[model samples]
Target: MSNGPTKRAADWAETTGFARLDAEAFPDFLPGWVWLVGAGPGAPGLMSLLCYHAMQQCDVVVYDALVNPDILRWVKVGAELEYAGKRGGKPSPTQRDITLRLIELAQAGKRVLRLKGGDPFMFGRGGEECQNLAGAGVPFRIVPGITAGVGGLAYAGMPATHRDTNHSVIFLTGHDASGKMPANVNWPAVAKASPVIVMYMAVKHLGEIAAALIAGGRKADDPVTIVSNASMPHQQVASTTLEQAGAFVAAQEPPTPAIVVVGHASDWRSVLDWYAPALRENPIG
Candidate 1:
């Protein structure tokens, strides 16, 4: 029933090292249950082994827009692939419809995998989907994947937390349901909460966000780093300050699906940038 092509079991196993993994260590993908699995930030290689197990067992994969398409090559031979992706400013399936479809699929005794890019609980709406599943009495499990705020930043050589820089880090979203800056966020309090702040889905309102932070007692020249298309081949890293973030972003026009970090942690990127150099040295596969 798969609409997409699937690799031979032996070939895929050899390619992914699936054959060498201990099968008994992984739980069986049961029918009538849903697994909310994270596919990691952007790199297919970042996917967890358990996630790959689910990929091999699931009857259907309901994935997000941010999930790299290359990761889909792991799906089982007969499994179906469903695009339940939701992109900002683009035509997307309604949340209600997507949830309903999951319920419908599980009710039919299919092993369902709700695959998402980044950790599902980290602003990915995995919680809401689980709530709906619980209401419907659909058995479900959560498999946490690497969130972009942490994994993505690491790929850009920016640490979310460094003891010397700060004792705490805050992770927040840039927009609310209406697609504007989140009104409920206490910018002043957040400005003082931690020395490091990692924001997701913030590229659209980078200027306003930087302004609010600056107005809330954060230094205008505070270091900031934006990692776009993180962990992917075309990953981009942009460094700016709270004062010039708006203009810098406007002028440079960096790509979307970016993670914005505000604080001194970005300062370490000068020496920590390993991914870019690694890519450059081995440009050919």
Candidate 2:
């Protein structure tokens, strides 16, 4: 019962094949609006067609640090690109400032694309930006892309859900909005409730988090997998146990934008891993 134009367009696309029409055939998108899009984890090929079309049509793109640079290369030449990335313990733009910038661009009669890494709504703070745009009377659309928890795991050859390992999974941020291990998160409760856990932005605090899980009754030998720079050419994955993940990742010094998966599912990486072959064929050195 959604009456929105985007929904209507999607409906038309599904029923009448309007969505299948190539971007080259469509008219330029209207100005004075914003589209918040998820660019997927890091792979350019994983980007949604709608997201790609929006990038081509937008007058401005305000993107995050995690969005793949190769994907941004597709933007129409001469379009403005702004960086509004936020990283843990880094001097990044405030969320309010980024939201207001989107409003300003829309008011300037620009078709704006607020590009984010992974699914914009999933831990990307896209909802707050959308709310700001809505409050300012800016017409907007949300084009969801693959999130890292799912895509990152795939790149590491670990499924988020498996038939024998787990039926229920939990996804949580390693830190709160302030970039610290959330004291509000009852680790004991979560450890008891969820069999599989996927954490974002937790690399810096892995030691504390691992300790908490162990204190909460999770076994010290529980499987842990850290997939860093997921889906990118330089991607790396480190497999260890709850007691050793902190030390293992620290020793390897993997890059940022990583996803951590914990559960029996992490064990599947031993056999399910396929990225090694691909990497061996295309060695960085």
TM-score of every model versus the real structure: 0.91, 0.87
Compose the digit string of candidate 2's lDDT tens values, residues 1-285. 656667546656666443456433544568998998999988887888788889888999999999888888899998999999988777999999999999999999999999999999999999998888899999998899999999888878888899888888899999888778989999998887878999998888888999999999998998888889988778888778999988977897767888988888777888988887556444221
- Candidate 1 is scored at a TM of 0.91
lDDT of each: 0.89, 0.86
On TM-score, the leading prediction is: 1
Candidate 1 lDDT over 1-285, as tens digits, reads 986655554455555544556534689889999999999997887888889999989999999999889899879999999999888899999999999999999999999999999999999999999999999999999999999999888888887888888889999999998789999999999998999999999988989999999889999989888999988878888898899999998999989899999999887888888786567343220
Position 102, candidate 1: lDDT:
96
TM-score of 2: 0.87
Off by over 4 Å in 2: 1-28, 277-285
User: Cα deviation in Å at residue 16, candidate 2?
Assistant: 20
